[model samples]
Target chain A: MSESNTPRLPLLRFVYDGLRQMVRGRVVYWSWIGLLLAGILVGGWAYIQQLQHGLVVTNLTNQVSWGFYIANFTFLVGVAAAAVMIAIPAYIFHRQDIKNIVLMGDTMAIAAVTMAILFVVADLGRPDRIWHMIPYIGNFNFPASLLAWDVVVLNGYLLLNLGISFYIIGCHYRGCEPKLKLYFPFVVLAIFWAIGIHTVTAFLFSANVGRGFWHHAILAPRFIASAFCSGPALMILGLQIIRRVSNYPIHQSVIDHLAIIMTVALQITLFFVVAELFTEFYNETEAVMSAHYLFVGLNGHDQLVPWIWTGLGMLAIATFIGTVHPLRRNLLLLNVAAVLTVIGVWIEKGMGFIIPGFVPTPIGEIYEYMPNLNEVLISLGIWSIGLLLFTLMAKAAIPIECGALRAPGIPAGKLICRPEQQAPEYRKEPVNGESES
Target chain B: MTRYAMVIDTRLCIGCGDCVVACKNENRVPAGLNRDWVVERTSGAWPRLETEFRSERCNHCDHATCVQACPTGASHHWGDTNVVLVNPDQCTGCKACIAACPYDARYITPEGYIDKCTFCHHRVEQGLDPACVATCPTRCMHFGRLDDPRSRVAQLLRERNGETLKPETGNLPNVYYLK
Candidate 1:
């Protein structure tokens, strides 16, 4: 401690300082922020129009009640769950290589969850009545409803990640070690919670026995496998970007580890896809209609045929690149594989996953669904908000993690101590001898 | 113990869609959406074709998935009447019920809550038949209490060997089709 003591600023000041750092960035950062803001504005305008006109403004009809919004919501749930990949290895297994980059996973989770919730709100015919789902204030059919389970798990996962990240970053800012006791239990819980979130979401779809496409026993496991692939692929890409833009010491080994995880997960996801295909195609049943629409054109409606095939192609290429030792080692190829994996999973999990269930509607009516302009704009806008949030969170947390910024008590320009490096300092404090004396 | 059920004789149905129009007017359903619809199921090819006209609406099942799936008690059975009804005030319009209904009978109303065939519970309360049952030109639609053996619905079910749509789903639909 310094001889001349300076009173610490209130907790609010730390938050203000963090937010201020987000705005004072370079031209590229400003441009990115501007772009996201534009999306938000455009989306907000469309949402206002929807509010005045109701869900009728969108292309959604009674036949296909859930469209682009729910699809994105479902995909983002998996993305949120993907945080568990890093959290498990880093926190549970104590892998040092993964520890530094786990913050990025947590940050991604926060952004994805925010986007997921926004997508749900966007899809609601009466978004204003969302309070009806809130506990006590509204009737939450918890035990009986999978959607209710989803609401709990998603929010729980979000809070877990947010708390863990904030505590670690707060410790970094104050030039002290985060108490393991405080965050370790939460991290462990979060690992299970992340899995729960995705499982609950999968059950939300699968439990709908009405929708033959989603009513599969393998759905939850398939969700986890796909989440692992897409989440880590996104993390790998994000780590590469961070490594390029900042002084953060994102190790190459971390990227390699993530690639290996993605590769195995992608393989398992593909296996599940094939298994699902076999089950559906083995017999000519009414249940096969949705899968038929996905793989081939159902009647005259073939809008999604191209998209699903493209996703499959991308998945194949990504898996090939990810598996080969030399290709995996090559940074460019690895990045390409990561991008492919993300896009493939996005298509496979998003529209590709949601649309099939609606085609050949229960009454045997075939009404094709495509997102109208308003739906697209609103979706883009929500995505922009998520990106903006992630950008700001990353901007605030990264500097603290790198020791470029410190809390009020720490001297300016002093290097922040890493977790491993802080061990010796703790060891030097001879607690037992001092107590004995 | 009053189990309200409906029996629709597909053989007597003329594909006139009178029931659909009557139900729409009675419910004041939004334009471009339907509370009841007549589906034409056709099989075979060329000169030996067969077509069947079936009237479809909310099944008001013994185990209604919509009621089960509703996060709020918005979609529920109306006591002994056993007709599935939506409490507009409680509905959040989350559309979980719409997705859960295998029959695709539910639709989001202009008011933002789900709207479906309520078995004309208002008319039933007045000791009158549903608008569809009353206006059916062929008198193919029959609505009565299934618990009473003397009720027309029960007698028809016993005589005609009536079958519920998608009975394999185990929803135990109250609406039966007299083949």
Candidate 2:
């Protein structure tokens, strides 16, 4: 065995080593992967059916043109953007607790963005024609179309997170400290980019003067606040799961700190919700009918009332649990709060956000919308694909971060030069690494 | 440049829905969707009730939000005529334009591209009136070049008080309604 102090392998070899470790997991892991695969198969079948018979398969109509797919896309964008919550405190503020787990947030972001893109694909009536939105090769209406901005920001954010996370994990694998100069600027840009993804998504809705419920200036800020709440909450839950399933160290203090951030964000989100509600209810206008449909019943259509109230109720409970320090410290309660916060925000930001705008549509017509079986299955399939990607990424990354695996010739706990800065001799070492063992 | 516009005299409309049927036949709009429809707005107390019937379709605004929201330039103003039209070949069917439209006029066709009232542009290009205007039994629907002083639509606008729908939207719709 080559026991040289410096070990280097080709880029593809490193990826191969990482992927080899990914497929080798416990029985529970395999089962989980199997479940995700089943979901993907089912969803793919549903999508094929939809492709055969246009958007008529979904519950969407001319009146309710956008439905569950777009709602999920909007929410997932917030989830993708929420990675900045960890990035900001870890890199910018020099917080040590989140430093180790920040990569997980990036992993979550990659998965979330993948899902967001898939949801957009699922929602399209002619998804095959999607290349038309591509810049240059296709006629991209930049600057003017917020959808175009969304596409650019979403893809850019995905690449940024993927690059940074992979680079960090690769450095860890190579037993080297990542160059702060290279990553710091990207981290700062990611923070702003994260904010941009959700804000641009909000702009996508708000720019439409037609949808009165979404036209308010407060929508973007509200989206950010809610994302901050839900994103970190999901991360905490994920970290807790990782800690339980594996030997990954998760600090109680970090969970509590994240809970605090979520609490504040949840409170801010509620404030915005109340502000929007007051604005809608105080003066009864023609535009207020959609809001009426959301909060109350509009012209006998009361489908979304139960869901919105449930979301509000869950948000209140989550906020209360998160506020009490003792409750926040209790992992069980904290996780419950996190779960509730996620569900609440999912409902509030997803269906509650998109549907109300189209309820009493622009021409003052009420056409109720509900996702059909095909739509739900297709959505589930996309979510499964996201989860599968996340699991694979986490499987590969966590082991590297935990020092269970390392690059060729790089021993655990030993510091070496960054990959690019290594001597030519380092690149000539054996391709096989500890991951093979 | 000819700025083609439509002036619908709601006062003269009987709400018989001939225009709706004519538009569907002319545009070949799919079943369960519409390019045009009649809306009956009823107000006041039980004994003192008043109902106004107005036929509504694509406004084809000068500042068309659909045109702006379309990522692929699929929804564009038809040349200098300023009538909003969707190029199905270019449409990705993302429905961004549908969401952007204030009038709820656009719909995804069964073929998976957006479809809306095109002011019967095909007929207009051939120097014939729109199918809706031609088929209106009451002669309430009038179409002509808004920039032409001699056009009947311009003359009607000068004689009668005409208002566009949802003027607060600032879309500056080319379609006007005479009440």
How well is each residue in A127-163 modelled by candidate 2, as lDDT tens digits?
A: 8889988999888999899999999999999999999
Model 1: what TM-score? Answer: 0.93
True-structure lDDT of candidate 2: 0.86
lDDT of 1 by residue, A1-437 (tens): 44343345646767987988887878877998999999999999999999898898999888888889998998899988886657677766777768878888889999999899999888888878888888888977877877777777777777888898998887777667789898888887888888888888888888787789998999999999999999999898887777666656666667777889999999999999999988898877888898888889888889999999999899989999988977887778988999999999989988999888888788778888999999999999999999999989988887788787776768544443331221221213333233211
True contacts kept of 1: 0.68
Computed on C-alphas against the true complex, the DockQ of each candidate is 0.75, 0.87
List the pairs of residues colliding in candidate 2: none
User: Clash number for every model?
Assistant: 0, 0
Chain B TM-scores across candidates: 0.96, 0.97
In angstroms and one decimal each, the interface RMSD of every candidate reads 1.1, 0.8
Candidate 2: tens digits of C-alpha lDDT, residues B33-78:
8899899988899999988888899998988889999988889889
